[model samples]
Target: MANNPFKYGTIVQEPYFTDRKEELATIKESLNSANHLILISPRRFGKTSLILKAVHATKRPYIFINVQRAVSTADLAELIVKETLKRYPLERIKSFLKHFRIIPTISINPITNGIDVTFNPGVDSNILLEDALGLLEMVSTKKERLIAVFDEFQEILTLEKGIDKKLRAIMQEQSLVNYVFLGSQESMMTSIFEKVKSPFYHFGQLMHLKKIPFEDFHQYVQEGLSAVTTESNDLAKRILNITGCHPDYIQQLAASVWDLLNYKKLDREADAVDTAMTQLIAVHDLDFERLWTGFTKNERRILRDLATLGKLSSKDGYATSTTYSTASRMLKAGYLIKTETYEIEDPFFKNWLLTRLS
Candidate 1:
């Protein structure tokens, strides 16, 4: 009779969100100490949600920008200017940004007074990037500490050569601003932040999001699906195992199972879970197909081995490290995430792979 409590396809907020207590604590500690951090995780692992939660919980004056679609460094400047205006008034923010010798054109709509920002098409993009980071510095001066989050921060790699050097140069000067860079692509993120050759190498502490532990996940589900008549606790464990304890998939699978029981009136828990999984796989068919087709023959072989064997080590079918490297590139790209052992990135994807090869 009630709406499904489990949520996916968007940000999962409080009450509905499962345990991230330790993560929250760590994030808060970083913010309080004015430490810059790289919040790294694979796509859909809830990096955005965690960032939002941590920012809100800290109650700091912050600008959150997602530069995932930014086409150039100039575009990135416009994005930061727009997002900064969203948080602080245009007059106030513009005053701070105006100090920069190379700032974007900031304008307000005549009727709505909504802020819009842009840069000259002919200007050097590096200058635009410098001016953008300068704006953040100006704002940080207004408060004891300002929090700035650039979600999908790894996407900056495509902007221009030495963007990292430029960004690092500007950001390292901010003594009062606490910055959190959230990125979904672990490989690119790591390369940018961890490699010794990187400008951002050791610039900030690293935080990798692990899958929610089974005990915590089990308890969270049990609490949410109250007044359980069936053995939903056992079902929760199965769901976690099936989904590989992935943050988004756990919510997705839980939602599917909940939907079957609530709306479809599925009486059997097993039946509900099975139907849920089938429907989920249906939704992901095209995605999995694209992924499967993208791999080369050798890559396909590696995937088939992974799907068939469930793990990539100590088996007769075990491929050598070099053999796996070609496929393992996907691991760096976050297509395949590492756990206690090597496996496919997505559990449902493994199922789809099995179906395709079977």
Candidate 2:
């Protein structure tokens, strides 16, 4: 059987990556100019994939740091230094360490052939972090500016109290490095970058990534489905209709549909989508159940209404303002997305809720 023509749950490269022509051009321009960037998007919206694709096109030394992996300021610093070493050699970094107030203990790891950096316990982690970042700027030359991207950058607020101010201070002085901050949480990211009182106010060019436009994604899905089935257009529309053009969901549903057609050795069937949706929900039933149990009574009521009734109202002991408030919370939490109307973000979750209501 031909390999599945769809990919999801990971960074998608060319052939699998859908259209982002305008976004790619904008990011490439920003990187080429060495401008710091703040990219905000909802979860699983292909933020990482898009950023990595653009960064690779530059053909310059770059470091990717996911702020979520960082435990503390020191850990954040260590992560940055390690990524830097992977690109540059140790001999060059040692010269820059001599200027640090609290020098980190650096050693080479034999297993991975990579550098390991450690900071002393109880020392000022902020200083260690500053030095680590400075090393990047220091080592970079005018011709080769380094690109550093921090994913889940909103988590930095939880790391150190004044780290934002400290980061802004350090980033402002570096001219030879481009800093890119990416966050999945829109509210927190907005506060960090848009708020005047926040240290990152007007710090970089802000870019908000929305779902791939329907026309662009439709072509991509149809092309992939057409490889195996002749009824590709109808199947593509059905998948997009269910997924609302969600990038990750499109890949997942397409994968299932492909497997059902290829492995089951059946011709294209009308019920293929229904069967695939059922299988997808069955695979994620536990996660959906856990998510359902976490909601308050009113919250669950709201979700059930959206899932089954397709609309919610103020009646049935749920106040009008309360319903609005709950939905706004869900939208912000990534449970629902606002289109012409508020709907469950995950199509499979909506399907799962339908089963419960039935």
lDDT of each: 0.79, 0.88
Best of the candidates, lDDT? 2
Give the TM-scores of the predictions, in the order they appear: 0.91, 0.93
Per residue, candidate 1 scores C-alpha lDDT tens digits across 1-358 of: 5767788868888877878889999999888886798899777878888878988987778888887869888888888778877877666875777676676677777888787788778887777777777777777664457788888888888877788888898888878778889888878898888999999998887999887788998887765555433667777887888888887888888887877766646767667667788888999898888887888777777677778886654344545875668656868766677766667877788878877788
Q: Compared with the true structure, what per-residue lDDT tens digits does model 2 show for residues 82-115?
A: 8887888778887887998988788888998767
RMSD of each: 2.5, 2.0
lDDT of 2: 0.88
TM-score of 1: 0.91
